[model samples]
Target: MPRTGDEFITVLKKAHIEWGNHRHTSTRGVVYGEGYLQIPRSEARTIGIFNSNSSNTHIFNCNSTDGFLVNASIKASGSSTANDVFAKQFQGNGNLRLIGDWFRHVNAQVGDQVKISWTSPTDIEITKL
Candidate 1:
């Protein structure tokens, strides 16, 4: 049996992830909590977070010209066709930049990186390395 993007997230929700909220803006897209997160890896898999609201739920796009994707996986709900998710990481500046990708992680310290994860339907956990 194969799982859709949403179904895949269901499984990941049980992982060792911290939880936080996702706030979206017209000029800035979306941010996980307040500011940048610290990712711990030079090369890593990023997690994009979106609000469960229908306006944003139908799609998760992060093909930012300024962001770099290490790898990604998108899931679509076979049963509902409405549930979906896109998990990808974007690189920017020095740290792995996360802009149009999903959540926010625009800053970091040397030797440390930033990462994002889904905390809830409308929340994301910003992991700092």
Candidate 2:
């Protein structure tokens, strides 16, 4: 079953998403590997963190107050290794702005430089095609 936003964040925190004083930032063409995605200093935001998921080569979301966003995407290289499943479970904190797949590979350690990006949630009006 898919996890909620709050549940997701809890998992991230436990896994250790790089704790930064500033908010979000963008990926400046740097590739992040397993064990804590790096947030660059140039892309800091007021309330967001950008990360690359190693599994499907996608960018995922992790927030401070709100746990994990649900369905967001990131660009990754096709040559990267597949992310290992069955790592850990995420718990939400209820402040997710985006959404995506949650995993246990994130482990932002102390003093890890990360490139953050600010992505506001867009309200889209869906219609049957």
Candidate 3:
């Protein structure tokens, strides 16, 4: 049995995820478009989203709430799919965008900085900062 919070954390780290897990990946991004942000390929690599494949596009299905939009998603456009997936070309870089009216729901403005955090692999959350 764990006696303190810190001890519990250590125990959880040693145990399997089903027991308890608390880990996430975070990255900062700037809103470049009405509903999009550009993240460098290197940064995407650090966040574990970059794919060198240059053919398959990666999408991050996310959940966000601002009292209006219930669900939103982030897409990381691949090199080859960039032209077809989005109107803007990133010169082989990854493009992250908030689908639908999520930009307005989050009250995000062009050039505003936002934080992207995700746990496990699929769960994602975005916050303005």
Candidate 4:
């Protein structure tokens, strides 16, 4: 459950799957550890009425109205952490910083940046200054 802006970018670069970044911004749907992001049209049957994943990781909408376009990737299944979370998912605003299409910023933001960390086994801490 990496949350810091920088860490998020790293996680996205690693993941390479689509988990449905379902979210509602106008409704203020995205929480810290949890999310209102839910199943997409493709995975509607698999996830069923359960619109959102507790892990709050999957955020791939493929241009869906439910959520915005988050720049990240995900791994469906492979590592042990996947089970605890989801097959794989991405749920964050922005972490990838592309500089001139050839470089990127070490930190997503310079200072007073957003910090996301694990506060408990089933929770995450987000500090955006």
TM-score per prediction, in order, is 0.23, 0.19, 0.46, 0.20
TM-score, predicted candidate 2 vs. hidden true structure: 0.19
State how far residue 36 of model 3 sits from its true place (Å): 1.7
* Model 2, residue 2: C-alpha shift (Å): 28
Report the Cα RMSD per candidate.
Answer: 15.0, 15.1, 15.7, 14.9
Taking the tens digit of each residue's C-alpha lDDT, what string does model 1 give over 1-129? Answer: 111221112112201121223333355544333222222222111332222322334222222222443323232111112443321222232322232233333333334433344434422333343
Give candidate 1's error at residue 2 in angstroms: 18
**What TM-score quantifies how close candidate 4 is to the native fold?**
0.20
Clashing pairs in 1: 5-75, 5-76, 38-113, 38-114, 38-128, 38-129, 39-113, 39-114, 68-91, 92-97
lDDT of 3 by residue, 21-50 (tens): 222324543333323444444445444454
Please state the error at residue 14 of candidate 1 in Å.
Answer: 33
Lowest summed-lDDT stretch of 10 residues in model 1?
Answer: 7-16
Residue 53, candidate 4: C-alpha displacement in angstroms: 14
lDDT of each: 0.28, 0.26, 0.37, 0.26
Minimal lDDT window, size 10, model 3: 1-10
Residue 112 deviation, candidate 3, in Å? 1.1
Order the candidate numbers by lDDT, best to worst: 3, 1, 2, 4
User: How many angstroms is residue 85 displaced in model 3 relative to the true structure, after the best TM-score fit?
Assistant: 14
Off by over 4 Å in 4: 1-112
State residue 74's C-alpha deviation in candidate 3, in Å: 3.6
